[model samples]
Target: MPDLRLSRRRVLALSAVATLLPRSGLGQTSKVARIGLVQSTTGGSAALYGTEQKQAIELAFNEITKARTLGDIALQAFHADDGADRGQTVNIFQRLIRQDKVVAILGPTLSNSAFAADPLAQQAGIPVIASSNTAPNLTKIGDFIFRTSVPEDQVFPTVLAYGVRKHGVKRVALIYGIDDALTRSAHDVQKKAVDALGLESVGIETYQRGDVDFSAQLTKIKAQKPDAIILGALAEEGAAILRQARQLNLDPKTVFIGCNANISAKLFELAGPAADGILVGASWFAGYDTPRSKAFVEAYRKRYGTTPDIYAAQGYDAAYLIAEAIRRAGTATDSRAIRDKLAGITDFEGVLGRFGWSPERDATVTPKVLIGDGQAKVFAAAPAV
Candidate 1:
């Protein structure tokens, strides 16, 4: 709820000329690195995730830039609120390129916006990394576009396979938002995983983005008596589905599993007891015990006064990856050099896991977790095999 805009002083301080010059007596010239963040904040429903996304980006940028003497490569963040409008995202991306002269771009959060903004950034030759957008087309946009989030094709199979192999799930009812590209992609992947595992997709239903009533969908799903319900949507819609399912007295004696996006504190708060036993695939959970994750969670809490979400961890990892690229490139101005360095990066320890980018594999395989009852457990890992 705080003012999301950058302050005038911060803006002036981050400008190209001011950042490139050495401090009055430090005798150390700094490289001013401008990064533009284009995201949605417009629709009533879209605003739900905007504040959290912005806060995560700010927290990561703050942690990465603190006490650093990257001379002249002083990082600066500029934000543009696209309000989930496709046209607005395109316009903002162009303005940042022409006016702000940002070297890189990060996020429009949703894949719909990314689908619109990424092509523009690619055409302009700016390296763009997404924090949460996971449309499969995003990876194909250009070599210049990268994403910290796992692709749905990769993530859903892991979740589904785990459910079928480990949890003995035989039948699942999938409920998703057809309008959102990311959710649709997740559902498609879920179907493929179900078929491959020989588990029945008993009932499949779709909803719009802002529909508060899911009685109709839940009613049909309840009749099928599925072994579990798989949610392929954001937290808000997932919460609504669970709440409706409970109200319909259709509580099956089956476990509920959802994609990574459903593993959030807000989902629990929104659905109350209905969210109690829902299991979700997650990239990073606050309860993780890894030293790197512990340090990040502690630092983030101290700075933001709250536990960070998976998106925050992704944002942190993205910034660290960019910083490492800069360090390897040895020059902040050479974008191509940075890109090449990023591609060649290997054995780079990260909060999520070790990342090694090869020309053959554009995606980074990170560890995943499961969350329930406000606690996170390491369920399984994608082994190097």
Candidate 2:
């Protein structure tokens, strides 16, 4: 990977200022700092994702506190459950930034919520490290906006290319939730890839996030008999669509391809056997073969009595990112220093393995495809490229 650290000239400038200033940047300053963790803990199906993310964040923070990850500076997390409502997200973000005076924020869970609340943080010039917003142009929102989630632009084309080659997919259809920003953005990426691959566009369908019935959409898709139905939705929403499609017998031969959105327990629990035979590409897998990843999985299972999914992994790594940035910046209260440190990160080994930032401040990360097996409530390696 190319080095994404700041240029030597910028580093020299910062160093010069550090020499003139008296103890404010890194190790010289020690103060308590507040961080906002905004996620949807209540609003319907979204809690499936937000809950895991929240749990993982807490877990990571607990470990960091025990380890004194920030040295003399103490970090306090202010958790808020936005209920997956855009209005509530904005309100929570405002409170966190203004009243609580947090230096940084972790999330609002969904990309829809991110789009809704990120601007507030940008306006205030606070750093926002999102854990699970995968839509395109998310980091482009501003310099303060960064995400650990791999965008759909990077994830879809590769997954689709593999699916088409391995499964002989000739015709494709897209079913997405139009109400949510993440799914809408994913729909755009999937459509572009379909056209690029020269696949026939069979049927396109849209739904809201909480809708339970997809019979109408499934019936229309069944008529086209596309080889694959690409889903651009969160776990619960996608599960409902898949279960409904199976009930309609939407061509048993037709398989499903999903983005990171479907790689969660919600899909396994809600869709049951229907989740099997689906292809999914995600930035993190619970069974990833890395020492750090294995330890994380083992610890999570022992604590929660259940395996953590991609969202949990993202949240866990995000917490580590926050603490590491504060340590590098040498001040928990300096948001700009934290932001620069995050952008300058050359390598960070976490549950996601080695990680860094792109020039645009998006995560410079690679994704792997995992196949769903109905019997195991978890994803396994795709077994092939």
Candidate 3:
């Protein structure tokens, strides 16, 4: 069993529990564990991701509560909007722990905010199930922090190698959001993959997170005339880059490859024709035919009337994963016990295959290569073959 004791300072930070009511003929009242869901509902470029994540969390929680799988504890979830802002992320982290006394927190969407806000939860000795922060260093924040996303280091290389072999890609150009932590980290991983695979480096260009115009960067990339363009950014910027690449008359035959962020169906809608044939790496897609995947998709569609992408799938898995932690601990009242239980979980399969924690406390599952053709289609990469 993992350690369940918090530091002396952390134990001191915990608020005194109110006295329980004396047992009557009606029996002792059941305690409800409040789980705080912090997400980017209103602002930021990843708001769509946040919406899907929130819906999935709610859906999973409802299913678990209906099944009564968590024993005597009834569960309630409260949501807070971080708006994808770092300051707002910190504010909500404090509020969720102090006021709500939440057993755990779900997400704040982006890696940038996670880098800033996760430390607060770690200090409070609260376990956080990161729904979609894929940056490699996230779990290093503390023992209490965990994520459902496989790091870019584990995901990108295999996917990129497949794209290279399948599409006959030799020379590759790179574009990433310099300001965003996830994109910047992804760019580094892409570089390593390109080098390890012996692919030519044509050019590397970058933009700030909110920049719209990419003609200058695209033109520079166009000059290199690479066989593939690698995008290490979120959907909004990735879509914009594709649209701009098309407008600039960059070679139609040149393939566009993106990180996990490009797996969303909305990217297809945003970029329209430009999104077609774009390749991405993801741990979950709506098209997976497994029984668990099918059931999750059906429940999500019935509840929200929309097909969930990887973000939503991960968020749903995060809810159940935390609930399982509480169940395994035999008590939802103690945050330290829940953290220990989560750390002990291994080889649990959800919609994602073989879900478990790596030695660093991040997700250990590998992603499957997916191609966008109006929707994501499963593709086997050559390296995996």
Candidate whose TM-score is highest:
2
Q: What is the lDDT of residue 278 in candidate 3?
A: 81
Q: Which stretches of candidate 1 lie over 4 Å from their true place?
A: 1-29, 41-50, 358-363, 374-385
* Model 2 pairs whose backbones collide: 26-330
Please provide TM-scores, in order, for all candidate models, with all chains considered together.
0.86, 0.91, 0.89
Whole-model Cα lDDT per candidate? 0.70, 0.82, 0.81
Which has the greatest lDDT?
2
Report the C-alpha lDDT of model 1 over 26-99, residue by residue, as the tens digit.
23435656777665555644554555566666666665555463534666677777777777778778878777
Off by over 4 Å in 3: 1-29, 375-385
lDDT of 3 at 99: 76
Q: Which ten residues in a row have the lowest lDDT in candidate 3?
A: 16-25
Cα error, residue 338 of model 1, in Å, equals 2.3
Candidate 2 Cα errors over 4 Å, as ranges = 1-30
How does candidate 2 fare on TM-score?
A: 0.91
Model 3 C-alpha lDDT per residue in residues 1-385, reported as the tens digit of each score? 6322222213322311111111231133276677878778667568878888888887887787667777677666767667777887887788778977888989979898999989999999999988788887888999999999777788889788888778899999999999888899999999999999999998999999789999999999999999999999888888899999999999999999999777776787788878877887878778777898899999988988978888898998998899999889888679999999999999788988777898788877777887777433222232343
Q: Model 2, range 1-385, lDDT digits (tens) per residue?
A: 6322213323432342333223343344367667888877778767888888888887787677666767777666777777788887887788778877889999979888898899999999899988888889988889999888888899889889988988899999889989888888999999999999999998999998678788888888888889999998888888888888888877887879997788887789888998888898888888899999998888888878889998899888988898888889988678889988877887999888797988777777788888898767789888784
Cand. 2 Cα-lDDT: 0.82
